[model samples]
Target: MKILLVDDEESLLRTVQLGWPEPDDEIVTARSFEEAKRSLLPGRAGDFDCIILDLQLPDASGTTILSEVRKRTDTPVIMLSAWGDTQFRADTLMSGADDYIMKPVGIRELHARTLKAALLHRKRSSPKPSVIAIGNCEFHVQAQLLKGETHTTKLTGAEASLLEELALANGEPVLRTDLYLKVFQREAQFGDKSLETYVSRLRRLLNEHTEDGAAAIRTIRGVGYRLVA
Candidate 1:
């Protein structure tokens, strides 16, 4: 576990560097908002497992950094503030903070929360169906990236939902009606174009890596469709 520390207090930073849970890559320290951005960059999909960020920073507000981090990665974040304001706590959680800690916080509490955050992150980052392989393409359901051997495409929210339904079918034909009901959370009616449109989009996305082109999704005519290998 690599942890990024974004605090301006030199005394606390030094103590945390020497005393925190032993991260695999050592404690990464950032004293300002710009420095924190520098440490998190090049792969915003989390260079670290968890981040300990101070709500107060010299250059920019921690909320700005938090919003930016969420836009790019699923990394768990724990916001640190000197004040234990109720409104501040509510706002931070709404703005994508995973956990919150007030100053004069115990080291034990910090360790425990970090561990909790890590476990939660791991669970949420992976789908139950997990990695689904269809022929030569691999669909990372939770990550929302459909990967080919030499190419890749990102899945939209609707596309991922449809793919998850098809994956759960285990290559058996999943009815169009089932898809409509499961994905849209409503009863299917005739002439609903939503299901078919997403199916068409997924078919094209999967066909991007194949010799028997357009072969990953099988259309069973009057039945429905199945994910094929």
Candidate 2:
């Protein structure tokens, strides 16, 4: 899994990077919101599965970034605060953060917390059933496929997941914040564009299977998206 570490403190960023998961796990460091923004562009951060963010920054508040992030992606945000106030924690949660941690936390504890948050978020987002129907189309979650009356087609992991989220919402608009959290596990960094790309791919594939074209998943514009029945 890929992780993005965002903080204004250079030493802290380096410390987290050095103590991060094994070599197989990729890590990216951003010292400011601008840097983080640049990193998550469309492709870079879109691929990341987790984000470790500091509440205070030299350029902008993490909450500011959180608001912006909620507009585009659903990747989990683990907020790190030096202040460590209970109100701050509550505020972070209210602002759409997945988890919050205080400074002076050990590497092992941070790792454990991050892992737990990711797992919980994934669990909460997962569809209850192995299969579900969306506008006359059946989706097999385990198989990652869409089945129609006369057609069956494979879907990419991301596409299947996006569809499943919409179908589970039962046509209600799933907020972009939730979508980013459920699908990407965290906010897309400055360079990550994979979210949009995957949506386009799913639209094309869904269009191929249904006469309604891509309208099954409607773009809510400035909000998020919805899967209509």
Candidate 3:
């Protein structure tokens, strides 16, 4: 898998380079934000599996880079920083980081987490059909864009898949287990509240285009959900 490593520290960069799995692994290291942007310019977002980012950089903050990355693609991100405070963790997660790690990290653990996060991101980001319609709402899969009535906006990869699965089932109440399996293609993992979170986020995304109606996605207690469009 292709990876982008961003850190200002040359020593840590060398360590990461030596720690990676295969000699053929496509890994790019950038010591500054400017270089990172240059690396991105030559390819599309899906060209990289994951990005290992340091929170502190010479030109920009990690959050700034992360926000910009989110704007471009849904590539999984693992924040590598010396700051391990609760607030920092919360802030990064809210800003769209997949995972957080403190600096002076073990290469093995970083490799493992990197693989796991990249796999998850890849699962969710695979392109499907375009413009799935449920009730009145429309989901544009290729563009990761959504539209209903007069409004239109983009959705994250996971959010689009979760909504698409429920929407395909029409208004039927899908079981939580089934929904998880169908959407994520695996049993629940620790803190994989991402499914439920995507449901809520997708609901909000739907609401932007909906008018004068209760939200299209209804959470059935003890069950998964139903799309009312």
lDDT values for all models: 0.78, 0.76, 0.77
lDDT of 1 by residue, 151-207 (tens): 888888889888887776667787775576557755455677887788888888877
User: How do the predictions measure up, each by TM-score?
Assistant: 0.55, 0.54, 0.56
Worst lDDT window (10 residues) for model 2?
Answer: 118-127
Q: Which 10-residue span in candidate 1 carries the lowest summed lDDT? A: 17-26
Name the better of 1 and 2 by lDDT.
1
Error of 1 at 20 (Å): 1.6
Off by over 4 Å in 3: 127-229
Report the CA-based lDDT of candidate 1 relative to the real structure: 0.78
- Highest TM-score against the true fold, candidate: 3
* lDDT for position 9 in model 3: 98
Please say which candidate is ahead in TM-score: 2 or 3: 3
Q: After superposition, how far is residue 4 of candidate 1 from its true place, in Å?
A: 0.5
Candidate 3 lDDT tens digits, 136-218: 66777668778778777887766777777776564677678557665675555667786778787776666666652236788
- Weakest lDDT window of 10 consecutive positions for candidate 3: 205-214
Q: Indicate the residue-level lDDT of 115 in model 1.
A: 75
Residue pairs with backbone atoms closer than 3 Å in model 1 (clashes): none
